[model samples]
Target chain A: MRIILVGSDKLTYFLGRRFTSKGDYLTIITPEEEAAVDLSRRLKATVIAGDGSDPTVLQEAGAYQADVLLALTDRDQDNLIACQIAQDRYGVPQTVAIVNDPDNKAIFEELGVSVAFSATEIIGSMIEQQTASEEIRNLVPVAGSGVTMTEVVLGPNSPAIGRAIKDLDLQGAVVACVVRRGRVLIAKRRSYLHEADRLLVISEDDQYGQAQKVLTGEGA
Target chain B: MVSNLIGGNSSASKYIVVIGCGRLGSLLAGRLSAEGNSVVVIDQKESAFENLSSEFSGFQIVGDASEMATLKKAKLDKADCLLVVTREDNVNLMVAQIGRIFFETPVVLARVFDPAREAIYREFDIDTISPTQLSADSFMQKLNTHQVSTSAPTEGVA
Candidate 1:
């Protein structure tokens, strides 16, 4: 994938490295010259030094040809503007913005921009997994759209625990990954269940409600 | 009976609008309503009011409080005070700025999720509350004051 990352922060650098390691073409745009140098060296990705909110900078960074554009500046307004410009003007296929404030995620979503709440995307999912029941929470992409990833966490007292991953009888959910003690465990048919381990599951919008019940035991 | 119900001439009812109907919004709304003052809530998600009291009798609007349309729906123009308690610092800042600049609301309170962003919100002359920092500070204060008992349990206590 050709990914255009707009930000100079540590998180941007971290994501750049991940994309680079995946052998994906990555381009980074930042306002700081030092960040551009450091990240380019670290991730071996193309780095452009300029304000990401500027259309000329984005065009120079080759945002028009990018498969995914990430606007992850520390400033929410700047990130929103960058994503809007990338999506609306440059016609980027997929534009994601990192929203520091979780509440702003909705507004971004309303504006047709995919938002990744660093806090909620990571911490909330972890908490949800810790609080879910025994049924494995399947991770599924949003229906008719591959934009959003959804998962259900089984509460602690759920009856689904102690059962094998393949035995859950989930209807329309798929288990993508399982996280335990900060380790991402690949989902397998015979993986044994562990309490407080989060099953990274995904389901379409229509299947989310039923998937939540099958995984958490309350929704069913 | 009417005379008994009415307070002194100096004591007037204060209307408050609480944006973002999350835990903080619900609590503030309940508290203000309990004080015999009018309260209004604005939230994007309608499900946020699941835990709120029905008898509270406050106006609830399902929309982004930061937007002028939603704020006007909540009567931001006439509100005596505004509280932005959404989980996002940017939304809170936007709401506070709108309240201050457009509506000229007397008081605007905003919840800053990130401690690092507090100073930027403060620059707008809005009251900012950092739950993460404040909670940590309170915990440190308790530790420094030795309020938490450090004594070990005696044998066979279990």
Candidate 2:
């Protein structure tokens, strides 16, 4: 496949080296003269020194014929714009970007980019997997922007314990599912919260604080 | 005019938020406030507000526009119109997108140095002013006019 890389980061360099070694058509665009020269020498790919966000620079780098365009620029906007230009103008089959802000991946996806990879999302999920917190566990953020589903275990001394779900002020959050004593329980308004009950709640990003306050009652 | 564009019929002041308190942002905020509109100017650097006119009665916020919390503090969701004039194109684009898409502000505009980067804004139906393109066009037009009027070869230093 004819692949185009729009930045000189480690990921781009690694991909460029691998593609060249395998004899695939590869091109790289970077704004640094020394980095372009070095990449060209080491990776044997056509390297252009200019802002990759510019359509003219991409045109000069033969973006029209690229089968895949990877916008790995450090800035999320640059990456998004570069991928957009490749997809909209050049009609590249595949367009991907590396987003700096995890929240922007959803926006990029909505804008029609094939995919967006965010380091923050990856690292955040990794940390979530590794965390040993007894109250909150495996909080997997969903869709990158607004909502996340997580497991929260209420302690014996918590305020929500023994209270009906309807009584809790969980206006901004949802108690989607609940597990108690190795059996799945129906999560309804009348359902009662018990000590050590594992609740699967989905809440918006900004309302996580309110959801935590409602469930844990620590903000009292 | 701001109230009209913001879908409000009230003759009262409309809310305008300007991100980046640089020269252009400060001037805009000052002018809007002088017009009796409620304005808020935000910048990461507190010193940037020194450029604002003393007569300006708008609120000043010192924080990064890239953060959601900062934008919330600035009440961006309640803004009738938002102007993003940050030096970085990415920050401006992101903030403008949020103002337009998330907050559904009536008017969202930004200053982009790279004319090429304006395509993304155009795709999202956001407005952008490219100072680089505007200045270059004006300068080139003046240069051409001067050249056409001074085509005579100098015979001697008179």
Highest DockQ model number:
2
Model 1 iRMSD vs. native: 8.8
Indicate the residue-level lDDT of B50 in model 2: 96
- For model 2, residues A1-220, the per-residue Cα lDDT tens digits are 8999999778889988898889889999998999999988888889999988788988898988999999998877788778877887888889999888777788788767899989888998887666634687647888767888878889776788989999988866899878998899879999999998989999887788888878987642
| Candidate 1 Cα outliers beyond 4 Å, as residue runs | A1-220, B1-10, B147-158
- What lDDT score belongs to each candidate, Candidate 1 first? 0.74, 0.84
Q: Which DockQ value does candidate 2 get?
A: 0.20
* Model 2 segments more than 4 A misplaced: A127-220, B1-11, B140-158
TM-score of chain B of each: 0.83, 0.86
In angstroms, the error of model 2 at B85 is 1.3
Model 1: per-residue Cα lDDT over A1-220, one tens digit each: 9999998878898888888999999999989898788877888789999978677788898888988899888776667667766776678889888877675677667656765565557787887767454354334445668423554455687656787778877666666877777798998988876767677776655666676666667764
Q: How good is the docking of model 1, by CAPRI class? A: incorrect
A76: Cα error in model 1, Å = 7.3
